[model samples]
Target: TSIRFCLDGDEPGRKAAAELMRKYYELGYEVEDCPPPAGYKDYNEWLVAAKLNLNRMNKRADEPVRA
Candidate 1:
């Protein structure tokens, strides 16, 4: 399974991410906040990143079955 990272366009989202990261730490999950490449700002910046990740995942022959 994959964890989707999402936050609203405001300060609250940042705060939520911080708190959620702490929880993930307790649960032993490594978290990486998405850094917008180049001139982008957030996940929806290019729209292609998400699609590419999903597509690559789908095409992988040995991908773990997401529960």
Candidate 2:
């Protein structure tokens, strides 16, 4: 089984997710950090954006993003 870390896509949220992933990894568990896609913040934001069929950028939209 794999562990997934679903968290907010913000600075603090990312850090928290990383910490959780690390903790779980250290415990010998496979972990995945699954945050919402680049622009969205959380699951709610992702859902809202998906429903509206629009790109929703969070507050940190200016920050660098993953490819």
Candidate 3:
């Protein structure tokens, strides 16, 4: 069985993730640590950025072609 943890991209988050991973490993469980992207501090920010990017792509796709 595997466990996934989504943590912030800051120091505290990193520390917590490390601690949790260590504990889980000691308990013989597979741990997967997921942190936000480089510029994002948390999952919500990353999600918002992703949504905006997707919207921009869709808008571009809807534009008419030019000669």
Candidate 4:
């Protein structure tokens, strides 16, 4: 199984993610990096936005459409 590292887009976060990827690659493990969306600074923010979007979609789906 591959290992995924979800890191923030900040400088420190990017450096840490790079170091981890290098270390794990040297250890012969398949690793993937998942960064947050362009507008988001981190995963948590993106996650919240995604959840909110989902909730809005569900709410709209439950509403009756006008003729």
Candidate 5:
């Protein structure tokens, strides 16, 4: 099973994530870091952008491609 990480842009958040990453690394678990989108303030903004991206991808996948 894979774990999803939502990272924040703040200093404290970054530090926390870094420490967690180290621990995960030591445990040999596959971890992915989701960085905040450009122009975003925090995780909430990044989440919104990520959701939008996922929605767009789903819509595109459902559409028929033209030859």
Candidate 6:
């Protein structure tokens, strides 16, 4: 089995993920670091950014194009 770490986006979060990855690696388990996107502190922040982008794209699609 593999472990995917969705930890926080701060230094401490990264440190914790590293420690856990090492531990699991030693145990022969696959480890994947799935931290939040850059500039985001957590998954919620990333989702907010994604939602904003989606809204912007939708708005653009709704607007009439000028020839």
TM-score of each: 0.43, 0.72, 0.87, 0.77, 0.56, 0.81
Model 5 regions lying over 4 Å from their true place: 46-67
Judge candidate 3 at residue 43 and give its lDDT.
93
Q: Candidate 5 at 38: error in angstroms?
A: 1.8
Give the clashing pairs for model 2.
none
Per-residue lDDT tens digits for candidate 4, residues 22-47, read: 99988999999988889898989988
Task: Return the TM-score for candidate 1, rounded to 2 decimals.
Answer: 0.43
Per-residue CA lDDT of model 6 for 1-67, tens digit only, reads 9999999999999999999999999999999999998899999989999999999999999999999
- Candidate 3 lDDT, 1-67, residue by residue in tens: 8888789989999999999999998899999999888999999998999999999999999999999
RMSD of each: 12.0, 11.7, 1.1, 1.7, 6.3, 1.5
Kindly report which residue stretches of model 1 are placed more than 4 angstroms away from their true locations once superposed. 1-4, 35-67
Give the candidate order by descending TM-score: 3, 6, 4, 2, 5, 1
Better of 3 and 4 by lDDT: 3
Q: Return the lDDT, model 6, position 28.
A: 99
Better of 1 and 4 by lDDT: 4
As a TM-score, model 5 comes out at 0.56
- Residues 2-67 of candidate 5 have per-residue lDDT tens digits of 545667767777787788877887788877766676678686887788999999999999999999
- Model 6: which residue pairs collide? none
TM-score of 6: 0.81
What's the ranking of the predictions by lDDT, best on top? Answer: 6, 3, 4, 2, 5, 1
Span of ten consecutive residues with least summed lDDT in model 5: 1-10
Per-residue accuracy of model 2 over 1-67 as CA lDDT, tens digit each: 6899889999999999999999999999999989989888898988986766534444357668889
TM-score computed on alpha carbons, candidate 4: 0.77
Candidate 1: clashing residue pairs, number: 0
User: Tens digit of lDDT per residue, candidate 1, span 1-67?
Assistant: 3344565434666677778877886787877554445554555755777788888878895776788
TM-score of 3: 0.87
Judge candidate 2 against the unseen true structure and give its global Cα lDDT, from 0 to 1: 0.86
